[model samples]
Target: MPEHSDLGLLVLPEAVCLAEALCDLDWRRYVAMVELNFDLTQFYDHVAHRLGQPRMFARSIAWNRDGDPLRRWVMAHCGRHKQTRNQYWDRVRRHQLPLVHSGR
Candidate 1:
């Protein structure tokens, strides 16, 4: 991951919401949107429109580095990690297994 000097640009709560919304999109739609947008500005505009936040723009909440905290959070919370974690919890519940947090 690349370092970011402007780590504070994105608001955590808003970025989390955006990540969740992205995760909720069907794979095809996600791909289509990515294909259509030429840049992050256009992408953000489409996302903001979908999210009904017309005022939201890339400038207000942008990630300038590969190691942006928002990017890390989205990766951990929105994709394969989320799917696997959900599957694990579902199986645990089905088996009536007790959950033990290791406090990572």
Candidate 2:
């Protein structure tokens, strides 16, 4: 099967599988795993090495068309530290508000 579509996006089964595995991780763990604070080139390098597809990734990046899906996938899954914290507080408000409920 073809690894990429005509738009140069990563359509490889292995790449999709990798994206799924990466996205399943907790946001914090994903950030740590990807070292997201670093430049995106490092991310590309890391993924390429992990997938054993350096040439494919490199060419995709060079063509300026590949990696968008992977980048979007990573962004969608990670970098939600604030959102996670807010969710925790929301849970606390919803389930641990006995004082408020008692009007105390």
lDDT of candidates 1 onward, in order: 0.51, 0.57
- Steric clashes per prediction: 0, 0
> Pick by lDDT: which candidate is best?
2
**Model 2 off-target regions past 4 Å?**
1-28, 32-41, 55-67, 83-104
lDDT by residue for model 2 (1-104), tens: 77876666658877675765466455335444443334345555556766777656744653464447766655554455547645755886789776546556
Clashing pairs in 2: none
Cα lDDT, model 1, residue 58: 48
Off by over 4 Å in 1: 1-16, 27-37, 46-56, 60-63, 70-104
